[model samples]
Target: MSFLLTSCSTYPVEVTSADQLAGVWEDFAGRTVEFKGDGTFTATGMDEADVGEECSGVAATQQGALSLSGTYADVTFDGVDCEGMMLAFYGSPSSFVVCFTRDVTAGGCTGELSRKDDVTATGRHE
Candidate 1:
Protein backbone atom coordinates (compact mmCIF):
# COMPACT_ATOMS: atom_id res chain seq x y z
CA MET A 1 0.00 0.00 0.00
CA SER A 2 1.07 3.57 -0.75
CA PHE A 3 -0.05 6.87 0.78
CA LEU A 4 0.45 10.46 -0.23
CA LEU A 5 0.26 13.65 1.78
CA THR A 6 -0.29 17.25 0.84
CA SER A 7 -0.46 20.50 2.68
CA CYS A 8 -2.21 23.75 1.89
CA SER A 9 -1.29 27.10 3.28
CA THR A 10 -3.59 30.02 3.75
CA TYR A 11 -2.57 33.67 3.47
CA PRO A 12 -3.96 36.61 5.39
CA VAL A 13 -5.92 39.30 3.56
CA GLU A 14 -4.22 42.68 3.14
CA VAL A 15 -6.68 45.06 4.73
CA THR A 16 -7.03 48.32 2.78
CA SER A 17 -9.74 50.35 4.47
CA ALA A 18 -10.63 50.85 8.13
CA ASP A 19 -14.15 49.52 7.62
CA GLN A 20 -12.87 46.03 7.00
CA LEU A 21 -10.65 46.09 10.07
CA ALA A 22 -13.15 47.69 12.44
CA GLY A 23 -13.06 45.34 15.38
CA VAL A 24 -11.11 44.15 18.43
CA TRP A 25 -8.33 41.64 17.83
CA GLU A 26 -6.59 39.86 20.68
CA ASP A 27 -3.55 37.66 20.61
CA PHE A 28 -2.85 34.51 22.60
CA ALA A 29 -1.25 36.64 25.32
CA GLY A 30 -4.30 38.95 25.62
CA ARG A 31 -2.70 41.69 23.54
CA THR A 32 -5.39 43.53 21.63
CA VAL A 33 -6.08 46.32 19.11
CA GLU A 34 -9.45 47.97 18.61
CA PHE A 35 -9.92 49.48 15.14
CA LYS A 36 -12.73 51.92 15.69
CA GLY A 37 -14.99 52.81 12.80
CA ASP A 38 -14.40 56.48 13.56
CA GLY A 39 -11.02 56.28 11.92
CA THR A 40 -9.39 55.82 15.30
CA PHE A 41 -7.87 52.82 17.04
CA THR A 42 -6.99 51.64 20.54
CA ALA A 43 -4.20 49.23 21.38
CA THR A 44 -3.78 47.52 24.74
CA GLY A 45 -1.02 45.32 26.02
CA MET A 46 0.82 45.56 22.71
CA ASP A 47 3.99 44.34 24.37
CA GLU A 48 4.83 40.67 24.22
CA ALA A 49 5.87 40.67 27.87
CA ASP A 50 2.50 42.05 29.08
CA VAL A 51 2.71 45.82 29.48
CA GLY A 52 -0.31 47.60 30.94
CA GLU A 53 0.01 50.48 28.48
CA GLU A 54 -3.05 51.60 26.54
CA CYS A 55 -2.70 53.75 23.40
CA SER A 56 -5.53 55.49 21.61
CA GLY A 57 -5.09 56.87 18.14
CA VAL A 58 -6.55 60.19 16.93
CA ALA A 59 -9.00 61.81 19.34
CA ALA A 60 -9.68 60.86 22.92
CA THR A 61 -13.16 60.31 24.26
CA GLN A 62 -15.19 59.34 27.31
CA GLN A 63 -17.71 57.29 25.38
CA GLY A 64 -16.58 54.33 27.46
CA ALA A 65 -13.64 52.13 28.23
CA LEU A 66 -11.79 51.45 24.96
CA SER A 67 -13.57 53.99 22.82
CA LEU A 68 -12.68 56.92 20.51
CA SER A 69 -14.76 59.80 19.19
CA GLY A 70 -14.58 62.90 16.92
CA THR A 71 -13.29 63.16 13.38
CA TYR A 72 -9.92 61.58 12.65
CA ALA A 73 -7.64 60.53 9.81
CA ASP A 74 -8.02 57.24 7.99
CA VAL A 75 -6.07 54.21 9.27
CA THR A 76 -4.77 51.89 6.60
CA PHE A 77 -2.30 49.05 6.11
CA ASP A 78 0.33 51.67 5.48
CA GLY A 79 0.18 53.17 9.02
CA VAL A 80 -1.69 55.23 11.59
CA ASP A 81 -1.53 59.05 11.60
CA CYS A 82 -1.81 59.61 15.34
CA GLU A 83 0.28 58.92 18.43
CA GLY A 84 3.22 58.05 16.18
CA MET A 85 1.78 54.54 15.82
CA MET A 86 2.32 52.35 12.80
CA LEU A 87 -0.33 49.60 12.94
CA ALA A 88 -1.02 47.34 9.98
CA PHE A 89 -4.40 45.58 9.82
CA TYR A 90 -5.16 42.43 7.90
CA GLY A 91 -8.05 39.94 7.46
CA SER A 92 -7.92 36.23 8.12
CA PRO A 93 -10.50 33.60 7.24
CA SER A 94 -9.46 31.35 10.06
CA SER A 95 -10.10 34.09 12.61
CA PHE A 96 -11.23 37.61 11.74
CA VAL A 97 -8.93 40.63 11.44
CA VAL A 98 -5.23 40.79 12.25
CA CYS A 99 -2.42 43.26 13.07
CA PHE A 100 1.17 42.47 12.25
CA THR A 101 4.38 43.83 13.74
CA ARG A 102 6.18 46.39 11.61
CA ASP A 103 9.78 47.38 11.16
CA VAL A 104 10.07 51.08 11.91
CA THR A 105 11.80 53.56 14.20
CA ALA A 106 8.61 54.89 15.73
CA GLY A 107 5.63 52.93 17.09
CA GLY A 108 5.59 50.29 14.39
CA CYS A 109 3.27 47.85 16.12
CA THR A 110 4.01 45.29 18.86
CA GLY A 111 3.52 41.57 19.46
CA GLU A 112 3.49 39.04 16.67
CA LEU A 113 -0.14 39.03 15.43
CA SER A 114 -3.52 39.58 17.07
CA ARG A 115 -6.93 38.17 16.06
CA LYS A 116 -10.39 38.30 17.62
CA ASP A 117 -14.08 37.88 16.74
CA ASP A 118 -15.83 40.77 18.50
CA VAL A 119 -16.52 44.02 16.59
CA THR A 120 -17.05 47.69 17.47
CA ALA A 121 -17.75 50.58 15.07
CA THR A 122 -17.71 54.42 14.91
CA GLY A 123 -17.15 56.14 11.53
CA ARG A 124 -14.16 55.47 9.25
CA HIS A 125 -15.85 57.24 6.34
CA GLU A 126 -14.25 59.36 3.64
Candidate 2:
Protein backbone atom coordinates (compact mmCIF):
# COMPACT_ATOMS: atom_id res chain seq x y z
CA MET A 1 0.00 0.00 0.00
CA SER A 2 1.05 3.58 -0.66
CA PHE A 3 0.15 6.71 1.20
CA LEU A 4 0.59 10.42 0.42
CA LEU A 5 0.48 13.55 2.46
CA THR A 6 -0.35 17.09 1.47
CA SER A 7 -0.33 20.51 3.06
CA CYS A 8 -2.66 23.44 2.71
CA SER A 9 -1.81 27.11 2.36
CA THR A 10 -3.99 30.17 2.79
CA TYR A 11 -1.35 32.74 1.84
CA PRO A 12 -1.63 34.54 -1.42
CA VAL A 13 0.59 33.15 -4.14
CA GLU A 14 0.03 35.50 -7.03
CA VAL A 15 -0.46 39.11 -5.95
CA THR A 16 -0.74 41.57 -8.82
CA SER A 17 -1.97 45.07 -8.24
CA ALA A 18 -1.63 48.17 -10.37
CA ASP A 19 -1.74 50.35 -7.29
CA GLN A 20 1.74 51.44 -6.29
CA LEU A 21 0.88 50.84 -2.65
CA ALA A 22 0.06 47.19 -3.25
CA GLY A 23 2.93 44.91 -2.37
CA VAL A 24 4.75 43.19 0.44
CA TRP A 25 5.82 45.46 3.29
CA GLU A 26 8.27 43.92 5.69
CA ASP A 27 8.63 45.69 8.98
CA PHE A 28 11.88 46.14 10.87
CA ALA A 29 11.59 42.69 12.41
CA GLY A 30 10.94 40.86 9.12
CA ARG A 31 7.22 40.26 8.92
CA THR A 32 6.60 40.22 5.18
CA VAL A 33 2.99 41.39 4.96
CA GLU A 34 0.97 41.93 1.81
CA PHE A 35 -1.98 44.26 1.43
CA LYS A 36 -4.27 42.98 -1.31
CA GLY A 37 -6.50 45.06 -3.49
CA ASP A 38 -9.59 43.45 -1.98
CA GLY A 39 -8.79 45.12 1.35
CA THR A 40 -7.52 42.02 3.10
CA PHE A 41 -4.07 40.94 4.28
CA THR A 42 -2.35 37.95 5.76
CA ALA A 43 0.96 37.78 7.54
CA THR A 44 2.47 34.56 8.69
CA GLY A 45 5.67 34.01 10.70
CA MET A 46 4.80 36.92 12.95
CA ASP A 47 6.10 36.38 16.44
CA GLU A 48 7.91 38.21 19.22
CA ALA A 49 11.16 36.77 17.95
CA ASP A 50 10.58 38.39 14.58
CA VAL A 51 9.17 41.50 16.30
CA GLY A 52 11.99 41.66 18.86
CA GLU A 53 9.53 42.54 21.58
CA GLU A 54 6.85 41.16 23.86
CA CYS A 55 3.81 40.07 21.90
CA SER A 56 1.52 37.14 21.38
CA GLY A 57 2.54 35.24 18.27
CA VAL A 58 -0.88 34.37 17.00
CA ALA A 59 -1.86 34.50 13.34
CA ALA A 60 -5.08 36.25 12.41
CA THR A 61 -7.06 37.40 9.39
CA GLN A 62 -7.65 41.14 9.16
CA GLN A 63 -9.76 43.30 6.83
CA GLY A 64 -8.87 46.87 6.03
CA ALA A 65 -9.36 49.70 3.62
CA LEU A 66 -6.77 51.51 1.46
CA SER A 67 -7.24 55.04 0.30
CA LEU A 68 -4.90 57.17 -1.74
CA SER A 69 -5.08 60.93 -1.38
CA GLY A 70 -2.47 63.17 -2.96
CA THR A 71 0.79 62.06 -1.35
CA TYR A 72 -0.33 59.60 1.23
CA ALA A 73 -2.12 56.27 1.24
CA ASP A 74 -4.12 55.82 4.41
CA VAL A 75 -4.62 52.18 5.35
CA THR A 76 -6.70 51.16 8.32
CA PHE A 77 -7.13 47.66 9.77
CA ASP A 78 -10.30 46.56 11.55
CA GLY A 79 -8.95 43.66 13.56
CA VAL A 80 -9.85 45.40 16.78
CA ASP A 81 -12.63 47.45 15.23
CA CYS A 82 -10.11 50.29 14.75
CA GLU A 83 -6.71 48.97 15.58
CA GLY A 84 -5.08 52.00 14.03
CA MET A 85 -4.17 53.79 10.87
CA MET A 86 -1.08 52.97 8.86
CA LEU A 87 -0.16 56.07 6.96
CA ALA A 88 2.04 55.39 3.96
CA PHE A 89 3.90 58.34 2.55
CA TYR A 90 4.02 58.34 -1.20
CA GLY A 91 6.67 59.60 -3.67
CA SER A 92 9.66 58.02 -2.00
CA PRO A 93 12.63 56.16 -3.39
CA SER A 94 12.65 53.84 -0.43
CA SER A 95 10.62 50.66 -0.37
CA PHE A 96 8.04 52.01 2.10
CA VAL A 97 7.43 54.46 4.93
CA VAL A 98 4.54 53.91 7.29
CA CYS A 99 3.42 55.20 10.67
CA PHE A 100 0.77 53.69 12.96
CA THR A 101 -1.53 55.34 15.48
CA ARG A 102 -3.61 53.53 18.12
CA ASP A 103 -6.70 54.63 19.97
CA VAL A 104 -5.58 54.69 23.57
CA THR A 105 -7.66 55.59 26.58
CA ALA A 106 -7.21 55.93 30.34
CA GLY A 107 -10.09 53.59 30.98
CA GLY A 108 -8.60 50.33 29.82
CA CYS A 109 -10.69 48.16 27.48
CA THR A 110 -13.49 50.67 27.40
CA GLY A 111 -13.41 50.77 23.59
CA GLU A 112 -14.02 54.50 23.64
CA LEU A 113 -12.18 56.94 21.41
CA SER A 114 -9.55 58.84 23.27
CA ARG A 115 -9.07 62.54 22.93
CA LYS A 116 -5.36 62.14 22.24
CA ASP A 117 -3.38 59.46 20.49
CA ASP A 118 0.24 58.86 19.65
CA VAL A 119 2.23 57.23 16.89
CA THR A 120 3.43 53.79 17.79
CA ALA A 121 6.35 53.51 15.37
CA THR A 122 7.27 53.74 11.72
CA GLY A 123 8.22 50.85 9.46
CA ARG A 124 9.45 50.29 5.95
CA HIS A 125 8.58 47.88 3.17
CA GLU A 126 10.77 44.98 2.29
Candidate 3:
Protein backbone atom coordinates (compact mmCIF):
# COMPACT_ATOMS: atom_id res chain seq x y z
CA MET A 1 0.00 0.00 0.00
CA SER A 2 0.99 3.57 -0.63
CA PHE A 3 -0.02 6.90 0.90
CA LEU A 4 0.05 10.49 -0.29
CA LEU A 5 0.72 13.61 1.76
CA THR A 6 0.54 17.34 1.08
CA SER A 7 2.04 20.38 2.70
CA CYS A 8 2.54 24.09 2.17
CA SER A 9 5.26 26.43 3.28
CA THR A 10 5.25 30.17 4.02
CA TYR A 11 8.42 32.11 3.36
CA PRO A 12 7.58 35.80 3.65
CA VAL A 13 10.04 38.25 2.21
CA GLU A 14 11.21 41.46 3.84
CA VAL A 15 10.74 44.86 2.20
CA THR A 16 14.35 45.92 2.13
CA SER A 17 13.77 49.24 0.42
CA ALA A 18 10.95 51.72 -0.17
CA ASP A 19 11.32 51.48 -3.95
CA GLN A 20 8.62 50.31 -6.33
CA LEU A 21 6.27 49.55 -3.45
CA ALA A 22 3.08 51.06 -4.84
CA GLY A 23 -0.61 50.26 -4.86
CA VAL A 24 -3.22 50.13 -2.11
CA TRP A 25 -2.04 47.78 0.62
CA GLU A 26 -4.58 46.82 3.28
CA ASP A 27 -3.85 45.21 6.59
CA PHE A 28 -5.93 42.61 8.38
CA ALA A 29 -6.66 45.20 11.06
CA GLY A 30 -8.54 47.48 8.59
CA ARG A 31 -5.73 49.99 8.06
CA THR A 32 -4.92 50.98 4.52
CA VAL A 33 -2.09 52.93 2.91
CA GLU A 34 -1.78 53.97 -0.72
CA PHE A 35 1.79 54.44 -1.80
CA LYS A 36 2.05 56.96 -4.63
CA GLY A 37 5.64 55.97 -5.51
CA ASP A 38 6.89 59.51 -4.91
CA GLY A 39 7.93 59.29 -1.27
CA THR A 40 4.43 60.50 -0.37
CA PHE A 41 1.58 58.25 0.72
CA THR A 42 -2.03 58.75 1.77
CA ALA A 43 -3.63 56.61 4.45
CA THR A 44 -6.92 56.17 6.29
CA GLY A 45 -8.28 54.28 9.33
CA MET A 46 -4.91 54.43 11.06
CA ASP A 47 -6.15 55.02 14.60
CA GLU A 48 -5.71 51.48 15.88
CA ALA A 49 -3.80 49.93 18.74
CA ASP A 50 -0.99 48.92 16.42
CA VAL A 51 -1.08 52.20 14.54
CA GLY A 52 -0.69 55.54 16.24
CA GLU A 53 -3.74 57.32 17.61
CA GLU A 54 -1.93 60.65 17.37
CA CYS A 55 -2.29 60.89 13.58
CA SER A 56 -4.53 59.46 10.93
CA GLY A 57 -6.08 60.23 7.51
CA VAL A 58 -3.57 63.01 6.73
CA ALA A 59 0.00 62.46 5.58
CA ALA A 60 2.64 65.04 4.78
CA THR A 61 4.24 65.09 1.36
CA GLN A 62 8.01 65.07 1.47
CA GLN A 63 10.76 65.10 -1.14
CA GLY A 64 13.31 62.32 -0.74
CA ALA A 65 13.67 58.58 -0.65
CA LEU A 66 11.65 57.34 2.33
CA SER A 67 13.77 54.43 3.39
CA LEU A 68 14.20 52.46 6.57
CA SER A 69 17.66 53.93 7.08
CA GLY A 70 16.71 57.42 5.88
CA THR A 71 14.28 60.28 6.39
CA TYR A 72 10.87 59.67 7.92
CA ALA A 73 7.65 61.51 7.04
CA ASP A 74 4.76 63.16 8.83
CA VAL A 75 1.33 61.52 9.09
CA THR A 76 -0.47 64.14 11.08
CA PHE A 77 -4.14 64.88 10.65
CA ASP A 78 -5.59 68.41 10.51
CA GLY A 79 -2.19 70.08 10.24
CA VAL A 80 -0.85 68.28 13.29
CA ASP A 81 2.85 67.52 13.38
CA CYS A 82 4.20 64.03 14.15
CA GLU A 83 7.05 62.10 12.64
CA GLY A 84 6.17 58.65 11.24
CA MET A 85 8.49 56.04 9.85
CA MET A 86 7.71 53.24 7.37
CA LEU A 87 9.83 50.16 7.28
CA ALA A 88 9.86 46.37 7.63
CA PHE A 89 10.35 45.68 11.31
CA TYR A 90 13.75 44.23 12.03
CA GLY A 91 12.11 41.30 13.80
CA SER A 92 9.97 40.44 10.78
CA PRO A 93 8.51 41.78 7.56
CA SER A 94 5.36 43.61 8.56
CA SER A 95 2.88 45.00 6.07
CA PHE A 96 1.63 48.57 6.33
CA VAL A 97 3.51 49.15 9.58
CA VAL A 98 3.83 52.79 10.57
CA CYS A 99 6.19 53.57 13.42
CA PHE A 100 5.62 56.91 15.08
CA THR A 101 8.01 58.92 17.19
CA ARG A 102 5.32 60.24 19.51
CA ASP A 103 3.17 57.21 20.10
CA VAL A 104 2.35 56.73 23.76
CA THR A 105 2.69 52.97 23.36
CA ALA A 106 5.92 51.20 24.01
CA GLY A 107 8.34 51.14 21.02
CA GLY A 108 5.79 53.26 19.15
CA CYS A 109 5.39 50.64 16.47
CA THR A 110 2.19 49.59 14.74
CA GLY A 111 1.51 45.87 14.86
CA GLU A 112 -1.86 45.74 13.14
CA LEU A 113 -0.78 44.69 9.67
CA SER A 114 -0.83 40.95 8.96
CA ARG A 115 0.19 38.48 6.30
CA LYS A 116 -2.98 36.45 6.43
CA ASP A 117 -5.03 37.36 3.34
CA ASP A 118 -7.97 35.04 3.60
CA VAL A 119 -11.28 36.20 5.01
CA THR A 120 -12.84 33.45 7.01
CA ALA A 121 -16.56 32.68 7.20
CA THR A 122 -16.65 34.12 10.72
CA GLY A 123 -16.16 37.58 9.18
CA ARG A 124 -12.69 37.76 10.62
CA HIS A 125 -9.67 38.55 8.47
CA GLU A 126 -7.49 36.35 10.62
Candidate 4:
Protein backbone atom coordinates (compact mmCIF):
# COMPACT_ATOMS: atom_id res chain seq x y z
CA MET A 1 0.00 0.00 0.00
CA SER A 2 1.21 3.49 -0.85
CA PHE A 3 0.21 6.78 0.73
CA LEU A 4 0.33 10.23 -0.80
CA LEU A 5 0.05 13.72 0.69
CA THR A 6 -1.86 16.58 -0.91
CA SER A 7 -1.06 20.25 -0.48
CA CYS A 8 -3.60 23.00 -0.29
CA SER A 9 -3.35 26.33 -2.00
CA THR A 10 -5.03 29.50 -0.83
CA TYR A 11 -5.40 32.74 -2.77
CA PRO A 12 -5.78 36.21 -1.28
CA VAL A 13 -9.36 37.45 -1.29
CA GLU A 14 -9.52 41.08 -2.28
CA VAL A 15 -11.74 43.57 -0.48
CA THR A 16 -13.75 45.55 -3.00
CA SER A 17 -14.21 48.94 -1.30
CA ALA A 18 -12.75 51.25 1.30
CA ASP A 19 -16.11 51.49 3.02
CA GLN A 20 -15.36 47.95 4.06
CA LEU A 21 -12.41 49.22 6.09
CA ALA A 22 -14.06 51.87 8.21
CA GLY A 23 -13.37 51.99 11.92
CA VAL A 24 -10.85 52.99 14.58
CA TRP A 25 -7.84 50.76 14.04
CA GLU A 26 -5.16 49.87 16.54
CA ASP A 27 -1.61 48.67 16.22
CA PHE A 28 -0.10 45.69 18.01
CA ALA A 29 0.99 48.13 20.70
CA GLY A 30 -2.60 49.34 21.13
CA ARG A 31 -2.11 52.67 19.41
CA THR A 32 -5.18 54.28 17.84
CA VAL A 33 -5.20 54.70 14.05
CA GLU A 34 -7.42 56.66 11.71
CA PHE A 35 -7.92 56.02 7.98
CA LYS A 36 -9.49 58.85 6.07
CA GLY A 37 -11.78 58.69 3.08
CA ASP A 38 -9.96 61.23 0.96
CA GLY A 39 -6.90 58.98 0.72
CA THR A 40 -5.24 60.13 3.94
CA PHE A 41 -4.19 58.26 7.06
CA THR A 42 -2.52 58.89 10.44
CA ALA A 43 -0.74 56.69 12.92
CA THR A 44 1.37 56.96 16.05
CA GLY A 45 5.00 56.91 15.03
CA MET A 46 7.26 53.97 15.72
CA ASP A 47 11.03 53.56 16.12
CA GLU A 48 13.62 52.62 13.51
CA ALA A 49 14.20 49.35 15.27
CA ASP A 50 10.48 48.82 15.35
CA VAL A 51 9.85 49.69 11.71
CA GLY A 52 13.12 48.36 10.21
CA GLU A 53 14.56 49.47 6.82
CA GLU A 54 12.85 51.55 4.20
CA CYS A 55 10.62 50.10 1.50
CA SER A 56 9.93 51.53 -1.94
CA GLY A 57 7.15 50.31 -4.22
CA VAL A 58 3.60 50.80 -5.43
CA ALA A 59 0.21 49.61 -4.23
CA ALA A 60 -3.31 49.60 -5.65
CA THR A 61 -6.86 49.54 -4.39
CA GLN A 62 -9.96 48.70 -6.39
CA GLN A 63 -13.57 49.66 -5.91
CA GLY A 64 -16.33 48.13 -8.01
CA ALA A 65 -15.18 48.79 -11.61
CA LEU A 66 -12.69 51.52 -10.64
CA SER A 67 -9.10 50.83 -9.76
CA LEU A 68 -6.27 53.14 -8.70
CA SER A 69 -2.57 52.53 -8.25
CA GLY A 70 0.34 54.83 -7.53
CA THR A 71 3.96 55.11 -6.56
CA TYR A 72 4.71 55.84 -2.90
CA ALA A 73 7.60 57.44 -1.03
CA ASP A 74 9.02 56.50 2.33
CA VAL A 75 7.74 58.31 5.46
CA THR A 76 8.37 57.72 9.11
CA PHE A 77 5.54 57.48 11.59
CA ASP A 78 4.38 60.68 13.33
CA GLY A 79 4.12 59.88 17.03
CA VAL A 80 5.55 56.40 17.53
CA ASP A 81 9.05 57.59 16.63
CA CYS A 82 9.72 54.75 14.18
CA GLU A 83 12.00 55.04 11.18
CA GLY A 84 9.73 54.12 8.29
CA MET A 85 7.66 55.61 5.51
CA MET A 86 3.99 56.23 5.14
CA LEU A 87 2.30 54.23 2.37
CA ALA A 88 -1.13 55.23 1.18
CA PHE A 89 -3.66 53.23 -0.86
CA TYR A 90 -6.84 54.61 -2.38
CA GLY A 91 -10.11 52.74 -2.10
CA SER A 92 -13.84 53.47 -2.37
CA PRO A 93 -15.01 57.10 -2.52
CA SER A 94 -12.87 58.51 0.28
CA SER A 95 -11.43 55.49 2.02
CA PHE A 96 -7.71 55.00 2.44
CA VAL A 97 -5.08 54.14 5.03
CA VAL A 98 -1.42 54.99 5.40
CA CYS A 99 0.94 52.18 6.31
CA PHE A 100 4.25 52.95 8.05
CA THR A 101 7.14 50.55 8.39
CA ARG A 102 10.79 50.06 7.50
CA ASP A 103 10.40 46.54 6.16
CA VAL A 104 8.82 43.16 6.77
CA THR A 105 11.44 42.08 9.26
CA ALA A 106 9.26 42.28 12.33
CA GLY A 107 5.77 40.83 12.61
CA GLY A 108 4.71 43.54 10.14
CA CYS A 109 2.58 46.67 10.34
CA THR A 110 0.53 47.00 13.46
CA GLY A 111 -2.62 48.03 11.60
CA GLU A 112 -4.85 45.90 9.37
CA LEU A 113 -7.64 46.07 6.78
CA SER A 114 -11.16 45.45 7.91
CA ARG A 115 -14.61 44.89 6.42
CA LYS A 116 -17.89 45.68 8.16
CA ASP A 117 -16.88 44.85 11.75
CA ASP A 118 -14.41 42.06 11.19
CA VAL A 119 -10.79 41.80 10.08
CA THR A 120 -10.73 40.79 6.42
CA ALA A 121 -6.96 40.69 6.11
CA THR A 122 -4.00 41.18 8.43
CA GLY A 123 -0.24 41.04 7.82
CA ARG A 124 2.78 43.14 6.94
CA HIS A 125 3.48 44.28 3.41
CA GLU A 126 6.52 42.71 1.78
Query: Residues 22-87, candidate 4, lDDT per residue (tens digit)?
Result: 455543343444544543444343333323433211111111111213322234332333333433
- Global fold similarity of model 1 (TM-score): 0.41
Per-candidate TM-score against the hidden true structure = 0.41, 0.41, 0.43, 0.35
Clashes (N, CA, C under 3 Å) per candidate: 3, 0, 1, 13
Candidate 2 yields a Cα-based lDDT of 0.34
Sort by lDDT, top down from the best: 3, 1, 2, 4
Query: Poorest 10 consecutive residues of model 1 by lDDT?
Result: 1-10
Mark the regions of model 4 whose C-alpha exceeds 4 Å error after superposition.
1-11, 49-51, 55-126
Encode model 3's per-residue lDDT on 7-90: one tens digit a residue.
Answer: 111222345444634555455455566655665555655543333444343334222234443323433334444356334321
lDDT of 1 by residue, 59-115 (tens): 222122212111112222223232322343333433333333232322223343443
Best by TM-score: 3
TM-score-superior candidate, 1 or 4: 1
Best by lDDT: 3
Residue 117's lDDT in candidate 2: 15
Q: Which parts of model 3 have CA positions greater than 4 angstroms off?
A: 1-16, 48-50, 56-67, 70-78, 84-110, 114-126
- Which lDDT tens digits does candidate 2 get at residues 1-126? 111111111111221232544556544444455656665555544433332222222233334465654333445444433333433332233222332222212111111111111112542112
- Candidate 3's TM-score reads 0.43
lDDT for every model?
0.36, 0.34, 0.39, 0.32
Clashing residue pairs found in predicted model 2? none
lDDT for position 114 in model 3: 31
